[model samples]
Target: MNYAKDPADYPLAAKDPALFVHQHEGAVSWGAVFAGGVGAAAFALILLTLGTGLGLTSISPWSTGASNAKALGFAAVVWVCVTSILTSGLGGYLAGRLRRRWLAVDADEIHFRDTAHGFLSWAVATLFTAAILTSVVSGVVRTGAQTAATTAAASGSVTMEAMQRGNPAAGMNTWPLGYFVDSLFRMPAGSPPPATAATTGSNETPRAETARIFLNSAATGDPLSPEDTAYLSQLVAQRTGLAPDAAQARVTTTYTRLLQKISAMNTAAKSAADEARKITIGVSLWLFISLLMGAFSASLMATYGGRVRQL
Candidate 1:
């Protein structure tokens, strides 16, 4: 027995067209759902626009950075919930209101079927809107990636130069290791040289070579060889106009300073990135919860609306 066959052929058909057979009650009612879905989508778009205007009014670029970041995120969440509630509620209610009335069915079945129609309306509208939005988002991301690549190769030189002239206090967030390395090599103005000066007072030969060695060591993270260190001390002496002994001392001190700064910078950057990731996850979780609540509120409201006797 195909269990799904016309009950009229079976022992149960004539008993009551009302009771046992499930012919889907013309219940799908595609036409009504499409209508409701369209209405819902229109409502959703309207709400989205309204939300955007309100959100913009809540933020300003000139305000404190931390405050603005929080405000923008909060405003966005509120708008999302508002859009979901109003649009979904309107769509679901319209679906129930417009569905064809069922014949030969009990009140319970009628109510159940009616509510199902409303839910279907919401589901259909949500899917339609998501599809549209996905295409838009994909386009946006593609453009953003292209722009990022182009700017990275062009205007990025200015930003890189600015960053390299990095503030010892604030801008040090990006590269702690590099910052620390550079810090070790800096010398105070008017300091005596650590090692013997070059034969020419203006020519600091040892210090120049030491700088080359320092750069190599920093780039590769390899400790300087004794020869390299000795060469640097000589250069430091000549550059600072110091005797051999003082130049050697200055060179050693500067080298040690660079190592310490780099280590500290590395740790600070790792910690900051980790904190940002955690904050992002927390916001995402909240958004998910708000979405679910909006859906539930819309569905329950539709169910109630469906029960309203056709005044």
Candidate 2:
């Protein structure tokens, strides 16, 4: 009611949305919000860059604490929230404080206008920050992958060679999985596959049938069953020149080698990738929460700033 009677004392709107903004006539100033938003975004980039430097340097795959991906993900979310609040709050407050003072508008309307301006500033600042962050991350990832490939090439390591391939081979048999699989099989480079002998395109041969049996038998992580082992041994004896006992021995050796390789691969891959998947999920959830929090934070911060400006 303090400003109820003053409503009619001001000028009227001639256009749908006011284009000629009056410097001293409105509670929201676009120029001031733009300035504050850019400043907040710049400040956020600085903080995030510093945090990234510290973060990457701190964690390592060979170290003990490096394995704690959940903890790292939690910490990252907390940091993101803190940085968002600090940057957005400052920008919103500044937007509210610097906007034009509404001399003829009602106090309630003025407060609402200031809050809206702050919210707008927050939105703009977040977009600016996101652009910078996206560019930086994309650049870093490209550079890292390139560097990794270069280093692998220089070292003459098979793993690095495989990594350099644009599309890696499939796993185990049906397709190539990794360079490591070649090492597992230890077959001569030009030798026809032990399992693909005398095979036409469409129809499978006895050797291929044995391969299918072996692959199916090896599906479970455990070693091949005794029945599968015996069958595979017979297949090997028929295909190769070895005696039945020697064929079984070869099958046992081959299965043992594959089992060892798979076990090692499973441990490392699950260690690296499973945790990253979890981190990705956690970060996504945290980002949603942060966005909602940011909106509320800007509104409240702007309201308080507007009240202080009036006083």
lDDT of 2 at 280: 79
lDDT top scorer: 2
Least well predicted 10-residue stretch by lDDT in candidate 2 = 166-175
Regions more than 4 Å wrong, model 1: 1-24, 60-63, 155-216, 219-223, 238-261, 308-311
Per-residue accuracy of model 1 over 156-224 as CA lDDT, tens digit each? 232322333433222233344334334444455676554345554444333334445555565444666
In order of appearance, the predictions have TM-scores of 0.67, 0.61
lDDT of each: 0.63, 0.65
Give stretches of model 2 more than 4 Å off. Answer: 1-27, 53-63, 66-70, 154-248, 263-274
